[model samples]
Target: MPPPESSGPPLIGPLIAQLRLARRWSQPRLAAELCAVSDVPTLGRHEISRWERQLRVPGDFWLGWLAVVLAVPVALLVEAATRTRSLGTAPAVVGARSRSALLALAQRWLLDPGDPSFAAATGWLPPTGPPTGAGAAPPTGVPALPPTGAGEPPPTGVPALPPTGPVDRSAEVVRLAELRRLDDLSGGAELSGIGFSWLRRVARASSEATPVGRRRLLPVLAETAQLCGWLAADAGAPTDALEAYRFGLRAAGAAGDPALAGHLLGSASHLLASVGDPHGALVLARTGYAGCHTVASPRLRALLLHRIALAAALGGRHQPARCALAAAQRAADRVEEGREPPWLYWVDGPELAAMTGRALVVLRRPRRAVALLGVGQGSGRPRSGAVYGGWLARAYLQLGEVEQACAVADDALLDAVRAGSPRAVTQLTAVRRGLAPHRHRQPVRRHLALVAAAGPYLPRPVTGSRPDPTDRTAPPVGNGGADRPGTPARRGPGGRTGSSVRPVGGRPNGGRAARRTDGRAATHSETG
Candidate 1:
């Protein structure tokens, strides 16, 4: 077989070495941490040393793990490595002892207790000096700032993305239609709002133009107004997103697009699950799943079923969730092996795996769940960021790896902030709950304090009693002695529940529904 041609960029080992140095971690420490948290168990310290020495190019799994653990994007790692080669660093230059010194220095800067600044500040430091050699150069092929029209200096840091030209109304209409399909599949409401806002802004801006422009803008403008509802719903503002979807449906009816209207309704049903109304979510999912079967593509129908399964799982109905997931998988399999409609483009092998993983974890097979979803570990798509991290957190928690679970949960929290997703917030809260049992350990206690810090954004459950964040006292860890006469029984999900999972929704569904919303649904109207 012929050798494969290099495509987008080169993967250089020295760059990975340099980044590891920059973080101040020894090869062993990095390897140990990754192995502790990973789904696959093939890695070890010696193997990591080999990769760092350029004896081997670590495959996708290791690369992905590095991306998450280092808290840098995959593209940045690739870019930094190529830039290093352009500067001519030897591939084998970084070694155990040299890396150890760098790690020691980094630890001093980031974690030294003797330094007063370290005591006062969070666990990061300003770069001590300018970057050297290839690392000093600007990232390859990234554009420099264009001169401002008014001679105003360009804003600092990265340049703004180039502006798109006047809206393509037809394309906007098509995209709006596609957004509904995504909503139906994901059961998230923000999809409609995002689509609606994008279209509305375009349509309103274009409406004042000449007759031809107005004609060009009308369809897009109308679609935007309709889309507001779905985006609202997905973002947890169900009532508002619902209104937007209904308005869009009315427009579709007027446009003689029964199929489009059906798709919008289906999307609405998908979002009902996010509001603690799984039965309603299922009703919506089934309605959309069956309705999409007629005018929607097979991919879209499969997506609808997937959302139904997710809702059922979250609602604590295992049977329907399994059935829906199975049907969705079957439908997904029927899509031609290599071909898919544009509307169905987002559904792929990893996404299907992720949805199935979520269901299985809820079904109490977290080990299998991690195995199924771990394929996405290093895929580097931002859209899968939350699910990928959430699955890892869940798996680690289930496996009784408290420290690893906490770290993964931290990753999930950071990803949620980047994605600006409230659902991510709730999921992270569930992870925090899972870590609560270890609150007496210094690191876990520190993590719990951080969880309390997120209270303003992640609002705690209103239905049940919880330890006061202000208490600042550690929970008892280790096996409980013969219980005090009046204390509640210490029940755990699969025996790990004491530390992770909470009573929410006025009851604990064996710790699966760990986030409580005080009987009030998150209305996206507040933030969407």
Candidate 2:
């Protein structure tokens, strides 16, 4: 293994550390496992330590073995290594701890704009800085915003603002809502950079406005943060999402809008649940619901309850999960058009049905899940369709309906590719793992091939508990939970399956017809 020509801060080292820590493996253990898997005992704990400390770099031989043992793609490892070699003597890439510190500083800035610490925390800010010179090219990997003529709305999805004037709060609110609607068509990966840019603009505006103007702008700031966080999470940038949520929570607090704060908490909870932190998710969901129960609209209440239900199911609190789902449904039934917040325009009956169906699937109630998931698969929304369809396919697999599962998974894979949603891809990845035992079947093999073909369009598999494609004993597909892949499903109370099985389901809906509306009322046609 030849070392790089020039010294640089470790890029691949942190990634390797994260992967090893995620599996709770010590340096010696990882080294031993590498030797065992590759039938080469030349590497020792000292070598592993040197690689992790950036004192040495792993060459092709070690990289291949690491990829095989870590269940990560070789391309990802090579990219990290390549970056280190290219950026000689560059500062270290930000690690998780640094990211968390920056996020905390951002939240604090939102809480107290006059705080001095806020000024120092701007080093690694989002790509929201001033634009480059006219006709100059944008930096690599950052998309250039379209130029707009004077008096025209900004070519960016977010609206433009004057340099010095009283801000038009109502107009800005409407524009923000419009910007959010774009996410339904094009998933967050494409819009996250734009969303962060908008947020930076809003934050600057808030800082410059008068006290009265600042108060009005705070709500807008909170709303923008919420959207940015959602986009970041969808783009597989969980740290960015968390920062946005924390910032939004502070903005919501400053604005005295507990309802919006609750919404932010729920959004954060959803992110937590997606990343395999069910207990933390449940706590946040419950806290959010408790704080704003008196002020939240029926739809908002329903959304919070739905978050709680999903978190509970994922955490294996079956009874509370079911109860929360029932409450969410009742709240949904009571939703009054034109009374709810505009940001929640997407929380219609079908959406709730889909959410409930997702919970039921996690709870291992396949019979009940199929009917609800069938009704809730988002009409004309490819991302939502892919997400719900993935769950529906899982239900079919649970019921021993291989052909049906393959058919549904096929549609889901297409939708996932079309939508370009990492979340949808993650769901489909689980479904693929579940079908591993049935790979001998023609349909399963075809579906697996399709998934492989779509790999370029999809995000890499996440770091935790990824099952080997050839491992027939891989755990059943469920919501990404704490259970490691290939671990046997444990029985819980009443002989119910534990976290190893996806936590999802709801009571049977008795074949209720799905209400097919455009999600929002006619007056809010622009809203999602």
Candidate 3:
């Protein structure tokens, strides 16, 4: 890649990026466009990214095409490129020692999250200036791992360690399946580190695997990346989640599987929204659907539509959210069993209900959110129940049923901690924030305290959850803990409702789900 800045009007790269972001286009989408129109499919996101950073300027020939597509005059593009660049605008490049240190620390935390030493990565600061005279190489990352012989295994329980030989496609599939199940049992806080390392190992082994094995492995890589993204989102690490999704996109494109690529796009769209970039999220949602709506399976299309609707809801675009929601319903109804991909098992009735309800809650149609999400109260990931509880709490609060909302908030708090879910924690925070008006009330204060006191999820080995999708035998991660705790008496679906609560007017969502940089979801609503 070229340096981020260079002299003169020929600085075509940042110009491309500025225009693209202005149009809400992802780097991949623009790259795809270039590839489509080019004589030789020579460029991709890497090239587009390079151009934007002024790392390597695109030739004038491509610049003209980009200008036309960007709807900017060639003269304007040239003008922007000619301006002197500031080094401050360039991407931050960490020292190689820092990079190694960060990666090692990340890997260590993932494999052993509960270790108190995780404080290092969370708090460590770089040296203010240059390194000291003696030993200053980022603490010589990973101080004492057995540096194994040529053929021996590295160590037990140490993830991301080099494998002894080539990985087969089947092994990667099995691992992906395992990781997905683990994510369902817990969240990314418990699984991301290991899953990331697993992928790295698979990637390293790819060179040794046969051509046929590599082909099969690519799609698995894509899916694994999505799984990691999901984990990262749940754990409140949106950047890491998005990184995983981007990797998924690249792997999916290389694998030549539109379905997988579409899923990655949709999943990433959701992540973008979760991270508070609703407009960017909306753009990705549209891009995902546009790319695959025609040829994708009905289930896949429905998934994409759900993402679009979710992003719209988060962005407070009620009409668009509503339209997408309706389209998602239609697409969902058209799913064909054998035609849908195995990875889509989570996108069933419960998922549909949750997605719809989430949008509605944001849209301020809380009553409908309660009705739909409550009906499927027993579905989706194990920990989603906590999220459902929080959503229901917000809906109740809207209806002035303060007691019920408090009750629901209390119910979800334990699950939030048990599952280590940042997403759930976010919902709980919003629930508390909304209750500020009723702070004088004892119940509300107690609930607020509960929400505030809830700490990061600590992973305890779970057992007897859903049966492993790939393996016939039951997974060891069971639903025996907080997940199986006696069900709370919810007010929606089978339960009776309070008199103060108003009925939902159809299915409009009303609020923006603001995400903190740390990955917690917050409510950002508008009165449409």
Top lDDT hit = 2
lDDT of 2 at 99: 27
Candidate 2 per-residue lDDT over residues 1-528, each given as its tens digit: 111111122256556766786788888899888877655565577656545544334554567667878899877876766553332221111122212222222223323334332222222233231122122233223344565557777654434432344557887787688767878866565566667767777787777777778778888988988998787667655555666776776677677787998898888778767766565566567767766767889999899888888878888989888888888877888889999999998888888887888889899999988998899564888888888888899899999999999999899888877775566776777788899999999999999888878777763211211121111222222222224546454433234343211100111112221121111000100011
- All candidates in order of TM-score, best leading: 2, 3, 1
Cα lDDT, model 1, residue 324: 76
lDDT of 1 by residue, 113-203 (tens): 1333211221111111111111122112222234344445434422222125666666665666655454432323223223433644564
Judged by TM-score relative to the true structure, which candidate is superior, 2 or 3?
Answer: 2
TM-score of each: 0.48, 0.62, 0.61
TM-score of 2: 0.62
Model 3: worst 10 consecutive residues (lDDT sum) = 500-509
Candidate 1 lowest-lDDT run of ten: 126-135
lDDT for position 436 in model 2? 91
The worst-scoring run of ten residues by lDDT in candidate 2 lies at 518-527
The lDDT values for all models are 0.46, 0.62, 0.54
- How many residue pairs clash in model 3? 17
**Decreasing lDDT order of the candidates:** 2, 3, 1
